[model samples]
Target: MTNNSIAQPLEQAKSIAEKTVYSILFTISLSHLLNDMLQSLIPSIYPLVKTKYNLSFSDIGLITLTYQLTASLLQPFVGMYTDKKPKPYSLSIGMGFTLLGLMCLAVASGFYWLLLSVGLIGIGSSIFHPESSRVAHLASGGKRGLAQSIFQLGGNAGSALGPLLAALIIVRFGQGSVMWFSLFALLAIIILAYIGNWYKGAIIPKTKVEKVQVEKHPFSARRVSISLGILIVLIFSKYFYLASMTSYYTFYLIDKFHLSVQSSQIHLFIFLGAVAAGTMAGGPLGDRFGRKYIIWISILGVAPFTMMLPYANLYWTTILSMIIGLIISSAFSAILVYAQELMPGKVGMIAGLFFGFAFGMGGLGSAVLGKLADSTSINYVFHVCAYLPLIGILTAFLPNLEVKRKKIA
Candidate 1:
């Protein structure tokens, strides 16, 4: 064979090996959109359910606690197990739980049934996040941040759509309209089945992957632990603050601005849409710049807007909240990709841990803030939540991570 002919095939092999699978990433992102949209329905219906059931803020808080606990508690174990033994079809199986949850929610007779519905949806989320993260990693083609952002963008966009849909459908037609979302879950299941097929063929088998080289790190185990602790704190700050917005922002607007429920939901949709826009930025920016810098900017940069939100008039409150969502939403993609770099071989575990903690903290924050609102006022809750982002100052403690290149094929 000629030298040029030999070199050409080698180059082509390299190109194919390194090519980013945009098709899979976009497909999985669509699945994420469906999964999170279903989950977001629970909180999106908070106003309607609270009125219908004559629920106090405390009752709302309890419902969140139940759902979040179920979502958060099982994730690590699920990820850890799957890391050892891959389950390609688990994604569709998990979405089935979501399909069932929507049905349960549509016909819920009492608060307990409502709790059960959310709990089932949360369980589906607990399964979806870790495995979907691993799939994104596999399809990343070494562009981890950009890949994560694309994947997360689906989720944030879905979250934004949920409130708007609830306003249009659930609010207009009542709770039974929630069952209409089952069609979404079913669509996700069909798509995820296809992704699972790709996942089975394309994903690296744990046994065959270069486990040792992939996990190489200069930092000691203890340092990695400390850095993880700091990241956890950051997640706590971000999600706790988000809980205030996602769960109670409508109530705050109603109480403070005297807006109708539909109007409040539209504002919530705006804020979450900003969040979706922000999510698309964080991952790629982290890839181009550095995750540490992006982390610092994303987590801390929003503090001023959050602080100003409680004091703003309706016009400015809406503007400030949109800005806050745009700035703050960038943190997760950077944070997740960074942690994956820190412990390269444990992608599933780290995704699970971070996703779980974020959910758990959000739940806890909602419950605590709800009580505080009951005791003081919704205005006070916003004022208190405004301070949570200040905890991002601790980002200084995280060691700067160098991007590690690994074998793709």
Candidate 2:
């Protein structure tokens, strides 16, 4: 980097700190949509891959385990390093891996190759999430909850689209058609390049660390650690239940209702679309009220629907899934933003840790649940996962950082 450009960060940071940058927020959110849509393609195509390669449920579970672990394991380190190094162009570079993965997936001859393809995509996701999340934080102008929700909205919306797209594109045209999605990755790379340009000038350089005015939360480290643990447990409960839906909901629908793959995907799409709407509302609601209350309500509020989900008929199943999606999906944004508030200056690290933990839970959940499905039935798997959200009751133990912030002010 030139000295002239390098000297510009203080001015850029001042300019950025002045107000919320909606343009950048929307741009990064769009990139998130593209990135997650690619990642979702793997699970969305699970039925196709399972049949095409003569795979069992265990094989399907392994594919998710490989990808989720790859994505989950590296995320914290990536976030920690970038928190210090601040790589402006890394987002664009990460999308390159996704592009290659999509190309590989289109022609994957066997299950192992499919695993490799997804692993690559997982790596791309590990790199993309923490940094893109940091960009959302930087552009927030102190409205962190709103910023994160907008960012997550893109991801949730993209995830919703994946199943529908897979049904329309890959299912209709067959496995080779997966290559068509590489185009979106290519587009993301270009968009992220522009984002990188903006990011380069908008933050403090890695070569220099300025002292930041951290707002004290008036809580001890032990309390913070305890709170963090509670958050992790909540994440475990949430993602485990979600993994059941995202990974095996289609199977549940087909087996119980005797629906086509395309019809099942449409059902999944509707549920996830509700998730996207809930995600959009979550952050702003957290911003308006308190994150603690939002967290409590979001996680525990969906329990009744989940409890009833396993026993519903086709029509009630669809309605209950929508209710479950909307309520449960709202928790992540609030949880993430609350954690970020707990550790003020460690935004990237907190984001990485939470996002990583969430992914790990999801991967682990998929593997375990897949085994259960093989041994029992998809119906039984949902019946078991239905009770996981009861763990959300632990949200009560968390101290109110918002009240603390007000008092400190």
Candidate with maximal TM-score: 2
The lDDT, on a scale of 0 to 1, for candidate 2 is 0.89
- For residues 156-208, what per-residue lDDT tens digits would candidate 1 score against the true structure? 99999999999999999999999889999999999999999988876553233
Worst 10 residues of 1 by lDDT: 204-213
What's the TM-score of each model vs. the native? 0.94, 0.95
Which pairs, if any, clash in model 1?
A: none
Model 2: clashing residue pairs? Answer: none
- Over 183-236, each residue of candidate 2 has an lDDT whose tens digit, in order, gives 999999999999999888767532232243454568999999999999999999
Task: Count clashing pairs, candidate 2.
Answer: 0
**Poorest 10 consecutive residues by lDDT, candidate 2:** 204-213
Model 2 lDDT at residue 130:
90
Which regions of candidate 2 are displaced past 4 Å? Answer: 1-15, 205-212
Residue 23, model 2: Cα distance from true site in angstroms: 0.6
